[model samples]
Target: MRHLSPGELIDAAEGHAAARATAHTEACEACRRQVASLREALAALRDVPDDEPSPLAWDLLAARIGRAVREAGAPKPWWAAWGWRFAPLLMVAVLAATAGVGVTLWHQRAASGSAASAGAVPGADEALAQDADGDERAAEDPSWSLVSDLSAGISLDDAADVGGLPPLGGSERALWQLSSDERRTLASILEAELAESAAAAPIIPGV
Candidate 1:
């Protein structure tokens, strides 16, 4: 017994509702009046002709849209905008760092070259010849083998303590004729020289 809805009333006005809605419209005076009003409104709408839009209005709308689009233009990307702002500074920083590193490396190489020249020995050839003589002496006398091994990497010029000692080139037989005290003193001196030589010896790699 509920009153008819607006959609049912519209269907009733258009003569398109079910029989049940028609029966309700007949029984309900309120629904009947609403349907009559809807029908009258629809008839009035049909009687009045719709106004057509002018071509000038459409052309103006299109022109406004085109102008807006042109004004907006394609926006630059966020990174592109920021990158342009800092590009020169970033390039300058990179170049400066590269130049500084190059200068530092060049200075290091120059310093190492100067240090090598400063540390070089003028008597390198003479020392090499002395080592070769020591090698030959070691081969001839087993006693000199210990001396050769102790003096392997050590320069003969560094042996300041033993430099004052006389040469034993022809004094081997006279060594047995020395006094007891002289022999003991000579043995002590030899021991000290050996110890000093061994202590001053340089460590050779892979030996």
Candidate 2:
């Protein structure tokens, strides 16, 4: 007796040719056993439900895909679109701050310069007054020729001393010794000298 092949048994179990295979299985013991095995395998396969996705699962998948597509197509915000809009404003703010700082520094520098010039004024004025007095004395006296005498015997130490007075000490001392009028005059001369000196002095960069 010829036994049914496993493939034929499987086809028979699936009811592909139910009547003909049923007859073959009942007559042949080997074919009957093969059919039974095939039937068991088919029963196992049937026990597992079909893996086709449910309608709810399909909707969830569609929603996720739709969200991804929408995100990909969405336009950027206005700020992102025109990022350079604030750049000029930022630059202006920076420049304004810098200018304010520069103006403040300039005013402070001017005030400092004014103070320094004020301090130096008296000494310069006293020196000028002494020179003028020497000139006047020389002019009035034939015996005391100011230019020749100043050129001949006057050293820096002697020149530093004016009139019948002792050497002018520091600015403070000179100012202390002078009358109010003399002090004022000395102050003006010192101011002028300081202005000249400030003009002549080369500016040192970066305090």
Candidate 3:
């Protein structure tokens, strides 16, 4: 009960059957049925009318396929899709970072200036003690007297306003013209005095 292969049956359906194949299909019911089915299917396909595409339809289809292929193959630009949307956010971030750095630098410089002023303050006090010609000049400026009073415990509010010293705004030229060593001494003394004050001050609980 050996049967012909499907390939042999298809060949027979196409009318290209070998003599042996034809004989086998004729003798075998299964082979003959398979061959008949293939023949009928093939005949139906052949009988169906060929649909010819119009020129415009082919052109449009080709254009769409070509566009799709080009889009898929082309490398996409990062900025093109997202740059405009995120550029402002990036700029704002950069600005914020720059401002923060600037503020930090300003604080550092102000601290250095304050430390320098604190050092210079004691020299001005010494100037007040000395019978120098600058005494009359120092007395002339209203701001000079405040520096002397800071040595005597004045309000912290006043110190904050004066920036840890009286407003030495180029009024008394001698006060401005302190030597480096004198400034260093003034700063050290001021630091020691401040430490003593902090030690003496009463601490409030739950602060």
Assess each prediction's global lDDT (C-alpha) against the native: 0.57, 0.54, 0.58
Query: Distance (Å) between predicted and true CA of 191, model 2?
Result: 99
Q: Which predicted model would earn the best TM-score?
A: 3
lDDT of 2 by residue, 1-207 (tens): 556666778778777846666778889888877777878987998899988987799899999999998987876654433334334433443444454334434544455567568884224333334333433432454332322343354354533332232322223223334554664464466567867998988799553
How accurate locally is residue 24 in candidate 3, as Cα lDDT from 0 to 100?
Answer: 91
lDDT of 1 at 65: 93
Off by over 4 Å in 2: 18-20, 50-55, 66-207
Q: Model 3 residue 112 lDDT?
A: 51
Q: After superposition, which runs of candidate 1 have C-alpha atoms over 4 Å from their true positions?
A: 74-207
Q: After superposition, how far is residue 143 of candidate 1 from its true place, in Å?
A: 88
Clashing pairs in 1: none
